[model samples]
Target: MVLQFTDVRNQSHIRCGLAPMEGVTCFATRLWFSLTSQPDFAMTPFLRVTKEYPWKRVSSMYAAEIFELKNAVSYKLIPQLMGTSPDDLERIATPLLSGAPFVDVNCGCPSPKVVGSRAGSGLLEDREVFAAFLEGLQQKLGHDKFSIKMRSGFLSESEFPALLDIASSIKMAQLTLHPRTRKDRYTGRANWDLIATASRECEFSVVGSGDIVDFNTLNTLKNFAPNVNTVIIGRGALRNPWIFEEIRSGKSVCISRNALLFSLATFALLHEFQAHNPLKLLELVKQGLFFTPCLTNENLWQALYSRLTTSFYGTEQPISHLCLDKPTFAKVKMIWHALRSGLGAQFMHPQLLRSRDFCEFEREFLNIAKDYNDLIPLKYHSEFDWIYSGEKRNEKQESE
Candidate 1:
């Protein structure tokens, strides 16, 4: 049974969400997050709706998987769709809309591939078309059934007020603002001031995203923006699936090395059972290990890299054997680095490495966290001190 938006809002606590991420947040990962954490709602990664596309075609197989995820999570799981025009949405949204409890429009994807096609945040570039698209959606699926996920603007902050006006006119069930322009991508700090401003300007509930990876930030956001009652977490949840549980329970979260391995083992069993592909499952583990923030301990990177390369699921042979070609390893390293950097401004940017160095990085996985991996590492808060306290600092500097 799915909960309505009002039902979710009426809850006493601040609502937490697993944000929609294209490659990282899939059914398997969502299941892991739901079972391991306390997200009140979760969203499937954005589905690119195209006309007469084979991959977009809905199947019972896919529906059954969604059903299984629903059974596992036992909460609101919204399916998000992306398209350039209303025609694309009308053409390809049936299977998903029919199966989902509620639907979301994707207007905030910043990938060049998505933007080049004028589909994701690209829609925001053309205000007239975007407005018409929302109007058509309301006509097609009443006001209560859908929501919109968007960035502050396409290329500039100037576009947001106009965009917000159009979105509010439709009475969208909710509006989730990522608070960064497409130009910002995920490198800079998220503009929570814009989120707070939007909450004040618009009548609908506004959900904030970006740079919220721990309980402290969650608390800070709640106190900072009393109007912005919900937050959608992507990388934070991936790094520590127990984050939500810790936030809701208000307890310090400490994971022993064995407990962490045991949790991954359980996730591996479920992922393998569902995906039946060791290669894909291995990639997810690597992503989790790399994206999760770590303290600057001498052994932390070594332990993490080891876990990234070796098969932790206890398969007869290591997952490295499943890689069809040699070059895949290099691509994995580059991709993981980029993803980690994209989460916060302070993180080092990812760069391609020489093959030998890449192998060395892989081999460094000599030790997996021999010590416990605390989800709420002390420095996690310190890393983003600028974000939570920048306003006061700026005022002091001005006074000086």
Candidate 2:
């Protein structure tokens, strides 16, 4: 299975992977992806390189913290770097890939921020600069070890063959294509037709991304895009964490309510670990939209008010008071609304502070995160490290 990176392994062709999406795919989710689904290879979300501070701190500010974790779980964690200049790329690349293997260059991210900076799929418009970026990456990271992720092209599938030619010339370890032009974004159907064409055109293993959500969709793509080597999943992975397991074993997973709750609690626990500043904790918790996914459905306001302050707070009944209100995953509009309003943990699970037993491990663990440094730092270099350091500092200050 491509999911298993060992070259000589018995399993073959079974490559289940998670697509990298900004603000969504982080180490916590990466852990969930591998531990839960066991994808063949996971692509680190795009980390933009700027000339701001060289390799001093994180690029997007929030990007590097998630990418570089001390105990980065267990699995093949592939880091992706996106930059316009070879210098900026090398500047961050040195530290980003310090002890990492299999770095991937992103030419596929369609975010407006990415395109505005000319780092992601926008680079597809200029093949020369694009090739220059890859050649430089190859020179810095070596030829066979680095991979590249890209969309078909800017306008049409015409540029895909050229894109493959460039990837081939660099001897890229692998190529993952999200078969839509910059024009379509996520609106149009993924150009599986173009993916089929490029799979045959390229010598390297090609990974197909776009809309491989469920077991049926995964199976459909096996025949539909025979040319591609693996299937890459994005939003679907968030909506259904068991995607990899379902695809690999030829089984469909019924996402249970308990499953969603477990995911929510544990993810908050992980974010709380990395949290140094309260706002940071709140922000990362906000990203865990997939876990408690149901604020935007019907009766939005009622759900919001309930999730925030129920019998869990004030002169009211115990939160168990409204125990029956928390429905099994029916229509998740309420969860959706909360996520969009603010990616703040305070909003998503405001009652967490009130519950003595909501998530005990999280409560004790989050006690450490309660330090201001753990959330949004007043002045700290490594917010991730600050979580532990802040605890020590708080203790010292108290003793003093």
Candidate 3:
């Protein structure tokens, strides 16, 4: 389905998409968000294409999840492929296109490994290859059945103009631009002006991404680039799961402590089932529930803490029981780190992070949450420093 959002002023509609995040936003995470706070569309993490495996084998891994969830959910899940060869991309994308509304080519991932292979943002480094790849894919799949997601440039902003020129000449369903160079990684603020430039220049729909952390930021982006109707949220969504709902409702939705707990529980359960590995649960906990400051309100935390330790309401086990593991404790510590950065909270709660066992971890977690209950919930702005920090320097060294 075409993603559409009503613009009350002009009686028009704009589309919304969930940004594809690597190591996060997997099937279970997407499914949970679809059920909880549905965005118009969500892009899957890039499916790496390689010659070692046949196209059919590579495509089969993602086909089941994409087909099963498309009809089951309200949002559309588009499969994104990352590779340098046009032939490899076309072969893999053929099966996915049949099940998905559209397939997206990921030309924007800044991961060192992905770029080293001359895929992802590496495509931008060579203008001819980038143009030919999109042109060839368009010829095979047709313009309306597939799309492109990309960054402005590879090493510098100077490369953006030529890259945009090449991309705009091609016909596609939509083009999502993150407006940052591969070198920038996730350090500086996203350049919205470039998005406006793209909207003005491209014939197709343009989806703006990056730094969209709240309802206000969403509004600011729209105001900045009025023609760029579609937008995507990535790290921002992790900071506040209810962001999509908040944007749709046009108000700040205060997440209740119980709601927060339930969300964590639901995400954990879904992730466990999807991955089929209990240890894999730890990854989601660290990445998924970074919105810890949501429970800072005093009264909410008090009531929530009581129910959590004593007997969680409407759950078979207490919150402590669910969290009596290294994975859960790591998640708590990650949240604390988010809180420290977002709110400038001085207390790191070192004891909580230093907890030796699950029992101590759980106890320390509760104590820390209780101690910080008096703080007010502040707007979270994710710099995404953890993923991309010092990446450019390392990449430069690697290249040398």
Candidate 4:
């Protein structure tokens, strides 16, 4: 049941976890995921530390946020920090650990801003700095409470052996490897062969991450790489929140159209509570819908789109109208403000916009989802559109 990859290697049960995502995984997000499908562990988005800021106040604020909201969910929550300096690590570790039981150092983030700062994947490019940082953590926090989350390498597979060599000597609690170079940046295949090799060579417990969406894929990883004990899911979990529970149950995962719709509604409701401004909430809703699988079903997609627009605009207006006409940020903000002040209230579902308790909301939605699953045809009837297509979508559309 424990989330520690090393500790759970011999355990009879498997450990599934939610990976950290900036802007996407927040307090409300963690709660929604836990309620829908409990991942054994969850991590806060990587908190950036620099020579100027060094994450002093921001780290404490993050700690407080995690500590305050974690009680509402079941999973073990860990705070993740990103930095190149050992001093930054030494400074943030204690305050962060004060709020959560464990702190995960983020050495795997591939964002250009992070890499440009000589942190995240950039750390992989500097062996001496990375070693000093790890040694600093060991000296300050001890290996029992702190862990590292890293990629296979910075630019190539060459960095993996060197990283593992340094990592094996260090006494980290656990290590989660994403098995992709910084150059990969979520593009080609995940290189599970590298994962298997790392699992065999590394002395510490290693968790495999990248492209794990369902139980079948999880099983594939387990069978292919017996050494990897746990798996961390990122974008896959966001697309289908129920995946973790389905994997845990060892059942064939089937996400009904209604299920996807209900999850979207739940996300909007949850996000409303945590977001500071209406625009931020709208952005999150747009992002969530963009990632969700319901776009594959027209009925469900229309229902969600209607509900979402109505929730924001307080009317039955088409989203395309706004996207095509009122595309400016200021216009959208004005529309949101107008709706909040006047007519928007009447159109939104009273139960959702005015939802009080997350648990109660989740239960009610679960029932609605069950009804949809029973009433609708199990196979999605809609034609797949070009909106949710991948990187090659533009080229395909042009050719057509």
- TM-score, every prediction: 0.70, 0.64, 0.77, 0.68
lDDT by residue (263-334, candidate 3, tens digit) is: 555555554444344234233223433223222233443443444334323455554566434554454445
In model 3, where is the ten-residue run with the lowest total lDDT?
288-297
Expressed as tens digits, the lDDT of each residue in 194-272 for candidate 1 is: 7887788777778888878677777777665788767788866654566676677665455444333334433444344
- lDDT score at residue 155, model 2, on the 0-100 scale: 74
Considering summed lDDT, which 10 consecutive residues are worst modelled in model 2? 377-386
Model 1: residue 114 alpha-carbon error in angstroms = 0.5
Instruction: Locate the minimum summed-lDDT window of 10 residues in model 4.
Output: 378-387
Query: What lDDT score goes with residue 284 in model 1?
Result: 49
**Predicted model with the maximum lDDT:** 3
lDDT (Cα) of model 4: 0.62
Selected candidate, larger lDDT, 1 vs 3: 3
> Can you give the lDDT of residue 265 in candidate 2?
40
Model 2 agreement with the true structure over 1-400: per-residue lDDT tens digits: 1223532231335566677877556654564454445565566677777787445755333433334332333345567777777677776666655555556778887778789878789899888988888898778766555677889897777887887788777776778888888766765457677677767877777778886656667667778777665667875565455566656555554332233344444333333333324344334334542232331122332343344332123333222232221221111222222221122232234443334444442343345334433222111112122122224555445544
Report the lDDT of model 1 for residue 313. 39
Top-TM-score candidate index: 3
For candidate 4, the TM-score is 0.68
lDDT winner between candidates 1 and 4: 4
lDDT of 4 by residue, 1-400 (tens): 1245332322325678889988656655765676566677778888776677764466223443355433434567778888776676668777766766567889888889888988888889888888887888788887656788998899997888898888878887778889889987876557788778877877777888986756777777887689876778886675456667667666534544444445444455445534434444434433544333342244655666566556555675442243212122222222222222111222223443333333344444454445453433221111122212233556545756
